[model samples]
Target: MLTIIGLLSTTFGVSVASALMPLISVELFAVGLVLKAPHIPWWALAIVIATGQIGGKLLHYYAARGSIRLPRFMQRKKAAERKGRVREWLDAFRANCRKRPAWTGVVMLVSALASLPPFAAVAIIAGWAKVPVTTFLVTGFVGRFVRFGALAIAPGIVSTWV
Candidate 1:
């Protein structure tokens, strides 16, 4: 019971930290491996960690969405100009997403799994672009699950080879 609680807390804390900063996820996965080795199953650990990560990422997504909801009139001139450029880009992205949702989904999945383009950036952009919350959550969870799952299993695999 105590071990389960510790594991849950560790996964939750690490997930929140990683959502705020990308690199920490990898580091925490490594730490989890070292700390939980022999006692916990890799798949179980991965699932827990991934779930926590998704939770944290949800917070990030909502925060970005809220930020973008701020009144345009309040923005400074330079900020407004930058916002215009971003809006233009987002428009194009939305078009592509509409025309080829499968392609967009694949891209998002691959990027999330590989940690390419950074998950935080992707999450912020997705939120700002008003990507459907269901799509975001599903793709993000799948990607994170694969990523953290691989990380969780790597040490055991390496030990076998060595």
Candidate 2:
């Protein structure tokens, strides 16, 4: 099905660019617009895109967590430092978790909503923060569903309302 293909491709694309958050966000936004056209049912498109993006984020987060091994060229001592960096970042997040749970949730939610295309930055940060995986996935799904759903519907809504 076209929907399945779109979801699969979008997930692959977003996952591949998780490390390049700043760039992919914009591209995803544009792609969302294109996917919103009349030919595509807004619900299907939104669901597919939202699910795909979340799936991609999880993929990237786990990849960064070192589940996937790097190439020999990339496995030098300097590269190994990245694992420590991830630990440090996770520590920083844990330190703030108790003192600022509400703020953390709000900020993560906003960041997830506002983040462009891939929105991997929020996921990476969440992972670094060592936030519970459930929390991250829930916020991500809700934020993305709202954002992509709005993108899919706003054009029609405005055209009719205005």
Candidate 3:
């Protein structure tokens, strides 16, 4: 029970911190391997870690959503140009979301699972795109669980091979 609590706290902290710092999530998975070797079962640790990760990512998603609503005040011409470019990009992204939701979902799932383009970036994009919370939570949990599970088992597999 204490180990579970500790795992939750550590994974949550690392996931939240990685929203700003980045790559700490991977390190946390590695730490989970160390934790699994002695105390927790890998599958249990994976679930706990994945749940913590999704919880922390929800924070990032909501923060991005809130920020996206904030009014922008651009005083400089270059800033205005950049804003225009960003608006165009967002519009295109939104169109893709609407036009091909399945494709977008696949991208989301693959990106989350592989950590391609980074999970934090994906969360921010999902927020900016107004992705449903259920989709976010489900996909994020599945992806992170798979990732952490693999990390958790790696040491044991290596030891057996050796």
Candidate 4:
């Protein structure tokens, strides 16, 4: 039981790191664990990793929402100080997101599952768009759980065919 707890803790830590740092690649780590630690259940790994990922992404979400203060260098320019077609387009898109929140949630969920627009970017965008926290949490979690679970179990599933 202690060993199981330790493994879970490790998965959580690595997953959080991977979420914060794109280069870390938690998917690779999970697949490696499946190959090396056959004793751990794939679904358990998926849940732990997904929790850690969501926790890490929450920081980005909050920061984008201006709930978490950032250093001057990291902060975006003030809206009044910024001007451009891109800015206007972004403002329009944000308004659209607010008007069609369900659509935004679906986009976020798809990004979480497929990394189409990139989950990291979507996390920040969802915050900047003022997406409801509950929606972000639910969609992101469900997508991530399914994605990581599939990866964690893929090796065993494939090997069984041979």
Candidate 5:
């Protein structure tokens, strides 16, 4: 389970996060039910997933909150360019958030569904848009509950297939 959590924490790198979720869910759900460990209940598993979303979003927030000035040796051509687009997009997302504060929850929910690349983009946008952290956490919990609930039940339904 700790290993699964670690993998999830590292999923910020790319689409690998989305790809690995199903496998992790299935494995964790199975292990929890099979071993029936008193310390690790099914609900706790759900919380891990739910809380993980917040952690991922925080990571995304930190990554996008700042503009890095790369050192001469390690800088790439691409890194040196595109400040305009990044600022533009961030500005637009902020404007959109102000228009519809509630919609940030929808964005959080959709992000989980789409498995959009560099998900931090969305997370950063949400934070910059001034979406309340409390609201983000609540919406994240709902999204994760749905996801974890689905995964928890899926093993039984697909028992024949697996």
Candidate 6:
């Protein structure tokens, strides 16, 4: 029981770190962890990692929404906010999201699974778009759960074939 608790805590910390720092590959960590600790159930690993990921990502969402102030060095410059293609596009997207709020959740779900837009970027965008907290939590958790669960089980599946 102590071992299980320790592993869970370590995995949660890694998951949060990966979410905050994209350079840290949580996918690799998950696969290696499952291989090293096959006794850990995939569902348990998924739940812990997913929860940690969402918890870290919430920080980005809040910062983007202007709910959190970043350090001066980390904050964007006023010139960077100049009217340009990306700025115009972001404004339009936000407006569209307001008219169809479900679209934001759909995008969040897809990004969480495939990471086509990058989950971190989506997290900030979701915040800037003012996506509801409930929507972000529900969709992000569900998507991350499925993603991590599959990854956590891949080793066992491949071992059987080998």
Best by lDDT: 4
Local distance difference test scores for all models: 0.71, 0.63, 0.71, 0.92, 0.54, 0.90
Better of 2 and 6 by lDDT: 6
Candidate 4 clashing pairs, residues 3+ apart or interchain = none
Backbone clashes, each candidate: 0, 2, 0, 0, 0, 0
Q: What is the lDDT, from 0 to 100, of the residue 44 in candidate 2?
A: 66
The lDDT, on a scale of 0 to 1, for candidate 3 is 0.71
Model 5, span 1-162: residue lDDT tens: 545544344322222243233334333533454244333344555555556655656655544434434357744345446588876885676787778876767777766544452334566665546676676667666766566656555555566586
List ranges where model 1 is wrong by over 4 Å.
Answer: 26-32, 67-87
- lDDT of candidate 2 over 94-155, digit per residue (tens): 68965786776776677667774335666766664566777777877788777776776776
| Descending-TM-score candidate ranking | 4, 6, 1, 3, 2, 5
For candidate 5, the per-residue lDDT at 119 reads 39
Question: Once superposed on the true structure, which residue ranges of model 3 sit more than 4 Å away at CA?
Answer: 1-12, 23-29, 32-36, 67-85
Q: Give stretches of model 5 more than 4 Å off.
A: 1-41, 66-89, 113-119, 160-162
List candidate 2 segments past 4 Å from native: 1-39, 71-90, 116-118
Per-residue lDDT for 1-162 in model 4, tens only?
348778789989999999999889999888888888878998899999999999999999999999999999999988898889988998999999999988998998898898898999999999999999999999999989999999988999888998
Model 6 TM-score relative to the real fold:
0.91
Report the number of backbone clashes for model 4. 0
Predicted candidate 1, C-alpha RMSD: 3.7
TM-score of each: 0.79, 0.64, 0.76, 0.96, 0.55, 0.91
Off by over 4 Å in 6: 77-81, 84-86
